[model samples]
Target: MSGTVLVTSRSFGSGGLDLERRISDAGFHVVRAGAAHELDELGPVLGDAVGWIAGTGPVTERHLSLAPHLRVVARYGVGYDKVDVDAAARRGIVVTNTPGANTSAVAEHTVALLLAALRGIPAADRRVRRGDWSAWYTREVSALTVGVVGLGRIGRSVIDRLAGFGPRVLGADPWVPADDPLFDRLERSDADAFATECDVVTLHAPGGQTVVDERWLAASDRPVLLVNTARADLIDEAAVAAALRRGRVLAYAADTLATENHGEGASPLLADDLADRVIVTPHLAAQTREGVDGMGGMATENLLAVLSGEPPVNPVPVP
Candidate 1:
């Protein structure tokens, strides 16, 4: 309770919740560090830190080894793949994430990217700035067959918003029960089935494996607009770029790049020719004010709970 509370998440307390003030009021000194969570930079503070509000950085065994007093690691976002949970668990440290906190924000961003790619919004804006005002035809959402890859909280929210568009929504989630209410309204299909039926395919699957590759694109019977607001590893960037070149993928819109955290030099999706068909954002899908507040509040609460000898609301199970 008297030691420092280390905060490595860049956007941890930037929300309306004033999470830093709350932590400070609990008699713990709050310390800030880089989102990268470098060993040298965090070594000094880790020794005195009781709780760590981590970002999308790796919390390896090396990091846990440095912090003898560390009791909990509250991930500031829903995804915790970057964190080394086994190391924390071995050290008797609780790991928690703000699940469903940014669901609405990310879902809205997914739909926005879909619309942007569909209507060529960025390209049109660029043309207008250069004084070219030629009109181009675009397909309406109501006319396209949209396929969603995951049916989790954010995926369900995306479907709910897409309902207003009146598109033929096809859902794909092997994890979800077949009797789930979502399948009642939409046809349940797999990602492979989407290639032949869907005009637009948005990815919401969990990361760790490549879902979209050259083989998947080559199986397509028509051009498909691909949107990914989930993870960078979800799609094979090189394959996607190739598909775009061949017109198999009409457009590729995503909120992340494989080399985004470092540099995008290796990604073929950023090539000059593919710029017309590729749209990439800097992983800001869950950076809305409301989303930030929800994530910050939940993370802060989790950290405080563990430090106060109470169980966290959202503890991640050790696998």
Candidate 2:
């Protein structure tokens, strides 16, 4: 467990490389690679590695089998969906992720998206840039009802931040207890019901398929403003596009997309339609300076702990 560490990272700005240097200074040989596109190339390089600081790479069972000396795989961010946790667990290699490190940043970004959508910030900015500045229009934040999906750490932070906005915040989390103070006015209902009732709907749900489908979009009683700072798969892309076309959704803002690594000619969500009403940030909700340092520190600590035969701080379930 004292060998060199392989860092299979996605494309990060120069700042990420600086962080890797810091890790190297901490007495671990860091073998840095851009991406995991060449698993064949990675196999030999990572053969003797004891720890891995991973990014959004496809670390499958086959990839795990290549590194018999690997004891830990520490993901950069909260989502470890791209990594094969079960495979790592089977090989007794602990998989860890930085969970709460980026919660505040994400929560703030979620609020930004919500405010941008509700107050027409993007539209107004575009209009002003084009010499079309008119007098400020009247808008009321208190008048809008905001609904939060998945009341986890980020969700709770969102709720806490939104408390001062004067909007009634409703939540829909099946896991939350009925008597919990967070669920004061929150309801344990379906996504459709939540969609139908709220003027602004912010998503904090995990990545998967069909969390927000055509049916949920169709069930909306009014033109809803959708903000998803969470995973892209929480909302169906095609359904959201259709919703935008028909005015079912007034506006939409997202920090993540269904396909992040969309190769040449790939259709990303809201890429074709460059409407001012929609705000799409390249998956950077948790890319703040503090977030990066915290995530890197936590991930490094987790890798160190696992390699030292201790439990990881945020262990992902394997098989």
TM-score of each: 0.96, 0.88
Give residue 96's lDDT in candidate 2 (0 to 100). Answer: 91
- Whole-model lDDT per candidate: 0.91, 0.78
- Report how far residue 168 has shifted in candidate 2, in Å: 1.5
Residue 71 displacement in candidate 2 (angstroms): 1.3
Scored by TM-score, the top model is: 1
Off by over 4 Å in 2: 9-22, 35-44, 134-139, 185-188, 271-274
**What would the per-residue lDDT of candidate 1 be over residues 1-319, giving only the tens digit for each residue?**
6889999887887777889999999999999998778899999999999999998777889999999999999999898887888999899999999999999999999999999999999999988999999998989999999999988999999999999999999999999999998898999999999989999999998888777888888889999999999888989888988888988999999998888655337689989888767899988899999999999999999999999999999999999
Over 4 Å off in model 1, which ranges? 264-266
Q: Report the Cα lDDT for residue 194, model 2.
A: 73
Residue-level error in angstroms, candidate 1, position 303 = 0.3
- Among all windows of 10 consecutive residues in model 2, the one with the lowest summed lDDT is 9-18
- Candidate 1: the clashing residue pairs are none
